[model samples]
Target: MAWDDKRVETWVGIMLRTGVMIAAAIVLIGGVLYLSGRGPSPRNNYRHFQGEPAQYTSLSGVVHNVNLHEPRSLIMLGLLILIATPVARVGMCIAGFLLERDRMYVVVSTAVLVILLYSLFFHK
Candidate 1:
């Protein structure tokens, strides 16, 4: 089972497409919910970025809102998925490199994944 560059490229493309499609679907659902008067009401206080609550901005907050079927949280989750597409692509690249026995690329992809993770989860 030889995993060549072309095969890896195809796999990455498929992964990106799938991730984007799923994210789009989730966003669409959230939009529908919002337009149907199911989400939170609009805010007029535009003084200090009084947008969503603190729970909706953080990861655990998003998850909690999602569990409560909050439309905005679903939309946020979709955006998160969209943001994660490239990260997943990089992960697939690492897997492909490992399958092809390409140590150099595996290390490089791993570093990229680490940086992405750091920026997404750890960086302020």
Candidate 2:
């Protein structure tokens, strides 16, 4: 099957929207965690440029069991918003390919998505 350009664009839009929502959600969750006394936000359970989070750099990235409150909630929110921008751009491309009814693109996206999901759960 092949989708026209308009339909492909729609799919791309959907993916972009999804990315935006995900970014917003991550920010919201991070804010809640930080305001609750956790510390700096984390990319995830793991830290970048470093193997482990030194046990003190969990989601909060603060002292163990210590929860103070977000000193810069707005900043964290901004960072998340920035993160989503590029994500949305790329997501749109992928989504568009799928929506275009390109079987090749669809299969590739599915494989990539599956791999990503698996890594998220079991790559540790």
Candidate 3:
């Protein structure tokens, strides 16, 4: 397939829109699940700066909770997917550049992808 700037823009727009929509749906469902019951907040301390639960703090923890259909985990998963959308766009850019025989952009996109992956997987 011949890639052009217009095609790149269209691809990026579609990716971003789809990612946001899916994430929004997940978050909305999770929010519904979380708010449907569980009664009122303890002591009505809505202003308190309580941190997130330990289960939502790590990748494995989130996955474990998600297996149990935990609402917060589902919400966090949506946020993670939202965050990953741009990374996926960068990957697509790399492929597009390769297809277009644009060596410089291919290299640049690869570097950016590597940096994103490093930050996501190892920088923590």
- Candidate 2 on 10-46: residue-level lDDT in tens? 6667766776776577566667665565545654554
Please, what is the TM-score per model? 0.85, 0.37, 0.85
**Candidate 3 local Cα displacement, residue 36, angstroms:** 1.1
Off by over 4 Å in 1: 38-51, 67-69
RMSD of each predicted structure = 2.7, 8.5, 2.3
> Which scores higher on lDDT, 2 or 3?
3
**Candidate 2: where are CA atoms >4 Å away?**
38-124
Cα lDDT tens digits, model 1, 1-124, are: 6899999999899989999999999999987886676446675567886567786667667766684256777888898889889999999999999999999999999999999999887889
What is the TM-score of candidate 1?
A: 0.85
User: Model 2 clash pairs?
Assistant: 37-67, 37-68
Cα lDDT tens digits, model 3, 23-106, are: 999988888887765557664466878877798777667766784346777889888889889999999999888878999999
- Give candidate 3 misplaced runs (Cα > 4 Å): 42-51
